[model samples]
Every structure is written in structure tokens, then in C-alpha cells.
Target chain A: MKVRVSVQLKPGILDPQGKAVEQGLHGFGFAVEHVRIGRLIEMDVPGADAAEVKARAQAMCDKLLVNPVMEKASIEVL
Target chain B: MRVAVPVFPGSNCDHDALHACGTVMGWDTIPVWHQEPRLPAGTDLVFIPGGFSYGDYLRCGAIAALAPVMADVKRHADQGGLVLGVCNGFQILCEAQLLPGALLRNASLRFIHADVHLRVERADLPFTSALKAGEVFQVPIAHAEGNFTLEPGDLADLEARGGVAFRYCSPKGEIGEAFVPNGAMNGIAGIVNVRGNVLGMMPHPERVVDPRLGPTGGLGIFRSLAAALARG
Candidate 1:
């Protein structure tokens, strides 16, 4: 099974990169009001059941992929 | 003093650390590889130098924190051994859970490389024994993900435990928004674990240890380590 994990800075944590991107969009005459940058990780997990794979992926996020203190991660079974 | 400096694959400052600790300070320093599963016997201090460990993959220090050698590093720390992490090393310590908080991207989203002033918050710790409280020192800081962040409760606990060792401040020793290079919480530049043996700081003390290099303000850190070892 394949899993996708999206990791983002927790709310109230400053997102400077996202703000820079928002400013760049404004400079280019785009109407992008708010921008928050994040990371998307796709990985192939060895499992037959989707539920099992999702759980394993979530575990991965908790352990290594995401920093629990500063980030929130959501896993999707693909 | 026997110092063990672990060299990760992408570690760039290992030699500098060796020079500062081994040559300048004349300590018995060993450069251990990350692949090694054990630290040398009688290791007094484990120094993690700054660099782009594992190319900053999966977040700074995330991958390097799990290297084979880290098991021994964790063991060493658990036994109340002294560990010092600078810049990238600081990131690794946090990732390894040897220290509190996480270093995030700079508030400006840009890599900052410059000299900043630091205020010694607590001088009683082993790392700051050479400096007095409220003293200011100029040090070089170069990093992108150097802003330290932690949960509120944990932050309070860290403060209550006297874990904060250094704080960013102005050249004249005033701390405020104008002096904070990165948006670190409470302007913290360095901290110690609850055990007070491990220290993690964003500034490169090794870079400023020599007077010819720049300010020798950083010499106190190495001196403190040596003093700690001598006292033991």
C-alpha cells in the first residue's frame, strides 16, 4: 500500500516561508490572500490492508516524519 | 580530558571542533564515525559539531539523530555524561530527545550568517562555569532552521529547571526584538537538559574560540568543559 503524509507547522507557529511566498504572489499581481507552506511525503508501505498501512504511516509520522512539538501530520492511504 | 567528537557524513565542522578541543585546548579528542555503534571507553565529553547533517533531510538532524552511533550517544547521556551540540548539533540533540524544544526555520525564512551577542543566563552550569551571569559575548550564528520552539508547559518547566543557558541580546547586553537574530522563544540561544550535562546552542562556539579568528569569547565554553572534567 501507498501512503501520503502532509506535514505542516502548527497554528500560531510563525510560517515565514509561507509569508514570503504570499508576498511574492502579491508582487506578481496575484490575489493570493493567505499562504501556508507545508511538506507532502509519499511512501510505499508493505502491507495488504489499507487500515494497517495507514496506522503504520501515522506511526512513522509520529516517530520521524513530523516533529510533534512544531508540526502536525495527517496520513492518507493511497 | 577525553572528548569524543562524532562525525556525521555531512558534518563540516568536525575538524574545527577537533582543532578547538584537541589542538587549541590540548585535550585527548577522538573523532568517532556515525556508523560506529559505540563510543570509545572513558569518553568524558561527546561533542556534536555543526553541519548540514544528512543534508538536512526530513528536517534538520532528523536522520542523523538515528545514526548507529546515537544509541551510544543516548546511553552516554543517560549515564549523566556531558554532551554539547552546536548549531546542527543542537538540532540533532532536540531530535534525539536529549534536549527539549525544536529548531524551526528562521522567522525571516532566510539563512542568517552573522555575529550576534549572547547573554549568559545561568553561569552555574558546567557549560557556563567560566562565564558570569549577565555577561555578554559576541558569537557567530549561521543557520536557516535555528529558531527554537517548544510547548508552553514545557517551556515553563525548562525555565523552572534553569535550563536556559544563553539568550540573544544586543551588543551592549540589552535583549529585545532588535537583538533577536532568529525568532527563538524568549530569545534563547542556548539551553541545557534537565540533567545540566547536555548543552545545545545555535551559535558556533568553535568558530570564535581563537582570538585570531575573531572574538575569543567562545573560549569559555571549552574551558568550562575542561574544568568540569577536572572537577570530576
Candidate 2:
């Protein structure tokens, strides 16, 4: 099974990378109004159970990958 | 007084912290490697210095938080030993859950490297006791990720309990917005734990130990700790 975990800084948690992207878009004369930078983690597991993969990936995020206080993480099994 | 500065992989400021301890405060500062499971005997203070620990791989201070040395640091803190973390050291303490909140990237998205103005918010802890409340000092900050964020309830509790040690300030005496070099919520530059022994601050107090190079903001911090140790 393949699992993908997407993590993003929560609202009210300042996102500097996103702000820079917004500024860059304005500088390039583009109409893009907003951009939010998030992290994506892709991993492969031998098991075929989607539920287990998601649970395990979520655990990985909570324990190591993401800081729960300032960021939210979602895991998708594929 | 004996001081221990834990050195993690990529920790470049352990020597700076050690130098500050020995040269400025006249304590025998010992540099402890990250793999040590126990701190040195009769250590008065434990300092986690700034650097890109673990290359800041998963997140800043994430890997170092789980290092063997932290177990000893946690034990020392539980026993009321003074623990001071500066810059990446602050991130390590937060990641270790010794302090609340998380430090995110700067709001401007640029590596901010400047002598910032800081208003001392507390005058009791071993880290900030030397400065009076509302006193402004120049301390240089150099970090890509240094924005401090906390929940509203936590911020209120911190302020009410004198846990908020320092705040980012402008030369004009304003806080938040332009005064905050990074978009740190409420301009919180430093904080102490509920016990007031564990201190986590983004500013590098170890960098300004001498007046010839810059302002002497760093001296107050070391002096505060050394004085506290002597009183014990």
C-alpha cells in the first residue's frame, strides 16, 4: 500500500513560505492571489489494508513528521 | 558553579555557550555530547546551544529532542536545575515539550539576522533576572524559523503567571506587526516553563558576551544564571 501524508500549518500559525510565494507571484506580474505551502510525505507499505496504512501513517506524522500544535496532517492511502 | 552545554550533531554554538559560561560567568562549563545518557556530576545548569541539529531534518530540533541527553535534561529540570536554550536550542526545548508552542518560519520568509530590540517581560527567572521589566536590550537574532506561536489561552496564562520572559519590541515601543521581526504571535521572543527553571528563547544571548563586538545583552543571561547558582 502507498500512503501520502499532507501537512499544513494551521490558520493563525504564520506561514512564511506561503507569504513569500504570494509576494513572488505579485512580483512576476501574475494574477495569483494566494498560495499556501504544505509538506507532502509519500511512503510505501507491504500491507494492502488501506485503513491500517492510514493509521500507521498518521501515527508517523504525529510522532515524527508534524508538530500537532501548529500544523494539521492528513493521511491518504492509495 | 558547573555548567553543562550539550552538543548535538551540527551544534555549532556549544563552544560559544561554553565560552560565555567560562569567560563571562567564570563557571567551569563542560561540553556534553548528545549521546551521553547522563549529565556531568554536580552540574548547576544545562545549556542547549544553537545550531542546525540533525540538519533540521524532520523539523528543527525534532531529532535532537529524542537524543539520549534529553532524558538527563528532563531529569535535571524536574530536580529544579536551570536549563537555558537559545535559538535552535529553544526549538529543541519546544520540540521536547519542555516549553509550549512551536517556532515557525519567519513571517517575512527571509533569514532575519539583525540586532533586535527585546523588552524583558520577567525579572525573576535565572535567565532574565538581571534585566528589569520593560527594559530594552539589543540582542541579535539569526534564524530562518523563529516565529513563536501559542494558543490564546496559553498566552494569557503565560502572561498572567510571568512565564513570558521577553518580548520583541521596536525602537518605537510598539509590539506586534512591524515591531515583530517575524510574525510571532504577540511578539513573544522568550518563555519559561511553569516552574521557571526551563527557559527557551529565540535570541542568541551567548553571541553578545562582549561589548566590543556589539551590545552586552548576553551578559545579563549568564550573570542571572550564575547568581542563581550561587544563591543555592
Candidate 3:
């Protein structure tokens, strides 16, 4: 199974990279706002089924993929 | 005073830290590998130095915080032993949940490399025992993720508990957003753990601790630690 983990800063946390990108968009005459920057981690996992794969991915997030203090993560198993 | 500095694969300041502790301060300081399950025997202090540990793959200090030697550091901290983290070390302390807040990127989205003034908030703690509250000192800060962040409630609690050890300030001791190098909350430069035995700060005191290297403003930290440990 192919798994993807998307990590983003929590809603209330400040994202300086996001803000800078937003400013760059504005300078380029593009009408964009609330531009947030995040990271994506893709991996291959072997499991009995999709359910098990997702469970395994979520466990990874809980263990190290996500930092509850500043980041939130979503896992997609494909 | 005995200091143990754990050397991660990408650590670049282990020598500086060891030099400051072992040479300048004439203390028993040794470098322990990250893979080591335990720190040097009878470790009195664990000083995590600055560097791009584990290549900062996941987060600044996320990977290094989970190194094998960290478990013993946690145990040592819980037992009221001293721990001081500088720059990348600060990030590790936060990532390890030994400190209260997380260090975010600079507000300008730049890697700041400059000397900034810091105002000592309280002199009663072990980390600042040789200094005086309201005293100002100059130290160099070089890191992109030094802007500290935490939930408002937690920030307030930390402030009320006197956990803030140093706040960025002007040469004359004026503190506010204007003096802050990174957009840290309340212009905080350093903070201590709840028990006051652990300290995490973005500035590189080891770099400027030597008197020959200009102002020895950073010397107070090592001196304070030596005094505090001696008193015990």
C-alpha cells in the first residue's frame, strides 16, 4: 500500500513561511490568501488490508510523524 | 562540575561546548555519542549543543530528541540534575517535551545570525545564580527556528511561574517586540523547566563564554552553573 502523511502547523500557530509565500503571491499579482506551507511524507507499507495500513500509518504519526505541540497530520492510504 | 555533551551525527558545537566546560571552566566534560544508552558515569550536567542533528530531517530537533541517550537524559532531568540546551539543543528540548514551547521560524522567514541582548528575568534559579535579575548581556543567536510559540494559556502559566529565564532586550534593558531578534512570544530568549533544573535557550553561550573572544557576557551561565552545583 502507498501511504501519504500530510503535516501542517496547527491553526493557531504562526507560519512564517506561509506568510512569506503569501506575500510573494501578492507581489506576483496573484489573488491568493491564507497561503500555508506544509510537508508531505509518502511511504510504502505492507498490511493485510487498507484498514490495517491506515492504522499503521496513524500509529506512525502518533509516534513520530506528527508533533502535537505545533503540527497536525492526516494520513491517506492508497 | 561535570558536563556530558552528547554528540549527534550532525552536531557541530560539541567541541565548543566541551572546550567551554573542560578548558575554560576546568570542569570534567566529555562528549557522549547519541547512540550511547547512558551518559558518562556520575554525570552532573547534560549540555546538548547546537547543530543540524540527524540533518534536521523531520523537524529541527525531532529526530535527535528520540536518540538512545535521550532516555537517560530524561531520567537525569526528572531526578533534578542540570540540563542546558543551546540553539539546536533548544529545539531538541522542546521537541522532547522537556520544555514548554516550540521554536518556530523567524518572523521574517530568515535564518538570523546576530548578537542580541538578553535580560535576565530572575537570578534565583540555578541557571542564573551567578547573575542578577534585570542584568543584561550580549550573546550570539544563529538559528532559523528560534521564535518560541505556545498556547496562550500555557504561555501565561509559564510567565506566572517565573519560568522565563531570559528575555531579549535592548542594551539598556528595554524589552519588547522591537528588541526581539525572532518573533518569540513576549520577547523570550530563554526559559527553564518547571523544576528549574533544565534550561533551553537559543543563544550560543559557549561561543562567547571565553573572555578572550570579546565580552564574556555568556560566562555568567557557566559560572552560575558551577556555583549552583558546588552549593549542592
Candidate 4:
């Protein structure tokens, strides 16, 4: 099974990197807006069960991949 | 005082912290690896230093926050042990929920490196006992993400409880809009817990401890902590 994790800064947390990216897009005249950069992590797990895979992924995130204070992460198993 | 400095993979400030505590403060400072399950015995102080831990992967301080050593650090804080986090260390403290708020990327959207002024917002905390409230001093901050932010209620709460330790200031010590260097919310640059045991600040005091580096105010942090430890 493969699990994908997406980590984003919590709603109230200020995301300067996202803001800068938004500004950069404007500077480039992209007409694009509302950009927020997040991390996408993909991992291979031994379990074939989707629930098991997601659980393990979350455990990894909590242990080393994500910072709970400023970020919230979602996991999808395939 | 016995100081424990955790060395996360890629952490570069462990030596700096150790030298400051071991040499300058004349304390037994232990450099604990992230994999360690607990701090060495008789630890009076714990320091998380600045560096691009785990290559700042996932997010700044994200990966390192979950290291085994953090559990012990959290326990130490719960037991009222003093914890001082600087720069990246500040990010880790916030990640661990030991401190409120988060450090966002710099306002200029670039890494900032220079000496900036800070006004002591709370001198009653053990972290700032040597300084007086409203006193302005200089410290060097080198990081891409140093802009501090907190929820509206939390920000007010921190101020109301006198947990705010420092605020950006101008050379002349004038505060408010003109002094904040990186546009941090409410001019916050550092803070401590209500218990006054944990302190998280963006400036690198260890880098400025030596007079040859330009400012001595930075050295005062370690000196104050050392004095408190010695007293106990």
C-alpha cells in the first residue's frame, strides 16, 4: 500500500512562505492568487488494509514528519 | 547548573550551546542526541539550539520535534525545569506546544541576518531577571522564518499574563510600529510560559556572547540563567 500525506499550516498560523509565494506570483504577472505551499509525503507500507496504512502514516507524521502545533496533516491510502 | 542540549540530526548549534554553558557559565552541559530517551541525571537546564534540523524537511522543526528526546524535554518542562530555545530551537518549542505561537517566514520573504533591537517586555521571568522591563538591547537574529504570530486571544493573553519576554525595538528604544524589525504581530520577538520555566526567542544570544562580536546584552541571557541555577 502507498500512503500520501499532506501537511498544511493550521488556519490561524501565519504562513509567510505562502504569502511570499502569492506575492511572487503577482510579481510575475501570473494573475494567479491564493497560493499556500504544503508538504506532500509519499510512503510505502507493508499493510494492504487502507485503515492500517493510514494509521501507520499518521504515526510517522506525528513522530517525525509533521509539527502538530503549527500544522495539520491529512493522509490518504492507496 | 547541569544543562542538557539536544542535538537533532543536522543541528549545528549544539556545540555553541555547550561551550556557552560549559565554558562561559562553567556548568556541566551534556549534548544529548535526539534518539536519547531521557536527559542525563540532575539536569537543571535544557537548551534546544538553532540549525536546519532534518534539512527543515516537511516544515521547519517539524521532523525534529518528534524525536525521542523531546518526550523527556516535555517532562522536564512539566517538572519546572528551565528550557531556553533560540532560533530554530524556538520553532521546536512551539511545535512541541511548550510555547505558544509560531514563527512564520521573514517579512521580506528572505533569510534575515543582522543585529536587531529588542525591548524586555517581562523581566520578572527567570529568563529575563537580569534585565529590566522596557530596557532595549541588541541581539543578532539569523533565520528565514523568524516572524512570530499568535491567535488574537492568545496574543492578548500572553501580554496580559506578562509572558511576553521581548519585543522588537529601535536603536533609540522607541517601541510600537517603528521598532518592530520583521513585522511580527504585536511586535513580539520572544515569550515564556506562565510558569517562567520555558523561554523561546528568535535571536541567537550564544552568537553574541563574546564582546568581540559587537554586543554584550546577548551574553546577559546565559549569565542570568546561570545565576538562577547557581542560586538554586
Model 2 lDDT per residue over B58-118, tens place: 7899999999999999999999999999999999999999999888888777888888988
Pairwise DockQ winner, candidates 3 and 4? 3
Model 1: colliding residue pairs: none
Candidate 4 lDDT, B1-232, residue by residue in tens: 7999999988988888887778766888899999999999999999999998999876678777889999999999999999999989999998888998878777777888888898888877767778888888888888888888777887889889988888888877777876666768888889999899999998888877766546677876887787788788
Model 3, span B143-213: residue lDDT tens: 98899988899999999999999999999999888999999999998999889999999998899888776
What is the lDDT, from 0 to 100, of the residue B119 in candidate 3? Answer: 95
What lDDT does each candidate get?
A: 0.92, 0.87, 0.92, 0.84
Proportion of true contacts reproduced by candidate 4: 0.56
Q: Tens digits of per-residue lDDT for model 1 on A1-78?
A: 878899998997888889999999999999996699899999888989998899888888878999999899888998
What would the TM-scores of all predictions be?
0.97, 0.92, 0.97, 0.88
Q: Which scores better on TM-score, 3 or 4?
A: 3
Task: Record all residue pairs in model 2 with backbone atoms less than 3 Å apart, i.e. clashing.
Answer: none
* lDDT of residue A76 for candidate 1: 90
- Per-residue accuracy of model 1 over B1-232 as CA lDDT, tens digit each: 8999999989999998998999889999999999999999999999999999999998999999999999999999999999999999999999999998999999988899999999999999888899999999988999999999999999999888889999999988898977899999989899998789999999998988877666787898888888889999
Measured with C-alpha atoms, the lDDT of residue B119 in candidate 1 is: 96
Point out where model 1 deviates above 4 Å: none
Model 2 scores what on Cα lDDT?
A: 0.87
